[model samples]
Target: MNGAQDLGGMMGFGPVVPEPETLRFHADWEKRALAVTLAAGAMGVWNIDTMRHTRESLPPAEYLSASYYEIWAKALANQLLADGLVSREELREGHAQEPPRPVPRVLQAADVAKTLAAGTQYERAAEAPAAFARGATVRTKVFHPTHHTRLPRYARGKRGVVEAVRGVFVFPDTNAHRQGEHPQWLYTVRFTGPELWGEGADPGLTVSIDAWESYLEAA
Candidate 1:
């Protein structure tokens, strides 16, 4: 899904301004937003890919205007509504109008530390041999999927060399749609700036992206 969130090589936006001191949250509500998102995620109603897709699926205008945490909050709300976890009226009133649905898993405060330490891992056992090896040239498939995809728009159809085999990992394209892990080989592909952007791009600049096997083909 092409959206404002995929601002990889696009122009017009000013240079990124880094904060003097990196704080986790800029405001109190942002903290709460993170907490709510984490808590809701514990229910296992959706995968991390689905959550990301929801965030990226926001309207271009709204996504551009929203802050970082605001996007998370909005995405969380959308998931809750879509999954039947909450009702539109309930969201509007800020109170439950009906009985709450029972969730299979709940995140207790006592388990927060352990849960945070054991983050979600996407890597899985290799199901088959890798199609391409290190130093092999490959091209990313030009695609505009309506569902979730990790491949960025700028790199589509571009040729790059496989730099490293990062092992098999759950394919986000299928995982987000509840189509199973569908694990595939992952690799770090290196591309010159000129290949991605126009020839005017800095020749000294090179970019590396971790691409799934499904997104690439032998060049």
Candidate 2:
């Protein structure tokens, strides 16, 4: 989906600035927000892709104005309400109004470390041979769907060379909509800056993106 979150080459946003890696949370509430988001995610009701879709699906105005964790918190609240785990009154009251709900798994305090260390795996066994090989030229298919997609808007309809075979992995487009994983071969596609940004871009500049097989076709 083309959301405000997909601001790549768009102008008027100002130049990108690098942030120091030393800083983690800017506020106490941010820490709590991350914990709550992770805890709710442990319910197994939705995957990461779905959570991202929900977050990015926020109204353009709302999505653009909110902060990072604000988006996460809002999206989580919406997901909770949509899943029937909480009611509007409960959310307003800040207390449970209905009986307890069952989840597939619970994240215990002791298991937090183990769970964090063992991240969920997205890679899946391939059912077919890779469609494109390293160094092969391919063009990205140009179409917009009203669902979650890993391919960015700026990169669509562009031609690039396969840089590496990243193995088969769960495709986010279908998985984000609860349609199924439908895993596909993954590849690192490298595009020249001039090809993507026109001749005005720096000739030596290049960008690489992890693209799924479905997003590319033989050039």
Candidate 3:
């Protein structure tokens, strides 16, 4: 799923310009987009990983040109369409052309505060002992999966040391594909900048990534 969105270590994008003041959104539509996405998500048709995969799966050109909330809006639309909740004609006309499908849960306005406070947790009970421990050296498996994966492209096949065991968590690769949580141990792996980038990368610079057990092998 290599796309324009995975520009972590790539060059030519120019330095990131941070806003002086943090704003929830830059436009009114952006607020509405977030609201719609949250509301749709409350229905439980898809999980958070699926939502992310939908956004990341957009065409490279479209993904690059789209603003942040625009991607969310597009992804939400795609999810709704894929789940048979809405039709293409209905999306164009901005009105329902058929009966609405029943959902398991609905997010009421009164419950918004409680729902926001109790965020969904991905952490789960460990099913087995961790394969690697802190200070253990490991190598990431080089992979290019067609489905959703949290492992970034730059870190693939790179060697790093386990810094900490973050405990077992729901594996997003399977969760996104409706293949169950398939919980696995997660760890913070530290890698030198040169290992991920090239020889020209700063020798003093180091990066840490929370990698899933499935992505790593003992080195």
Candidate 4:
């Protein structure tokens, strides 16, 4: 595990490095809690470790306001609710008499993993909606949808050149299910802060974001 110490002296926020005794203390505390929680069959107590965007993706207000654990907790709760493992009411109740319900038989982990491994799975079927090609001058669309999207706010509507032609990956725009896994040409779009924020931005700073084909258009 690349725990806290590994993140020291990075660009912005650094990692939390716990001392040896502190780590032992937390581990023992968590072990006891896990035993009790599991014995009680508490719903969704186990934290899910998944990749969220880089800290740079967070809005300035949220970035400073939230703690690392707070962010992780919110994400865990969101997944449980979204997956129907627990209802809003159940969430408020905190401890459930029952274990968190497993996902439906049709979408169980083993089955989903098998499908993914075998290369047959639900995927977005859209093709080529992007108007620009790699190496083309283009602008990121200023999109502010009601749901989750990978289009970072800082880079929106900014002009940048496509740096690379990375092949497609999951489209997080529609939903967390990776609603669209269909292949669309992807690009490493690089924008200078001066270009994105105009005169207020640091002239030498630049940010690169991986933008899907759908989020881009001709400049």
Give model 2 RMSD, 1 decimal: 1.2
For candidate 2, write residues 97-169 as lDDT tens digits: 7996887888899999999899999999989999999999999989888889989998999999999999999
- lDDT, residue 139, model 2: 95
Tens-place lDDT per residue, model 4, 113-176, is 5644665232345465555667788888886664555676667788998888776555654433
User: RMSD, each candidate, Å?
Assistant: 1.1, 1.2, 1.0, 8.5
Rank by lDDT, highest first.
Answer: 2, 1, 3, 4
| Model 4 TM-score relative to the real fold | 0.57
Residue-level lDDT of model 1, residues 118-188, one tens digit each, is: 98998999868999999999999999988889899999999999999999999999999889999999999
* TM-scores of the models, in the order given: 0.97, 0.96, 0.97, 0.57
Please state the error at residue 203 of candidate 2 in Å.
0.7
Report the lDDT tens digits of candidate 3 across residue range 31-56.
99989999889998899988989999
On a 0 to 1 TM-score scale, where does candidate 3 land against the true structure? Answer: 0.97
Judged by whole-model lDDT over C-alpha atoms, candidate 3 comes out at: 0.92
- By summed lDDT, the worst window of 10 consecutive residues in model 2 runs over 10-19
Candidate 3 regions with alpha-carbon error over 4 angstroms: none
Q: List pairs with backbone clashes in candidate 3.
A: none
Q: After TM-score superposition, what is the CA distance of residue 194 in candidate 2 from its true location, in Å?
A: 1.0
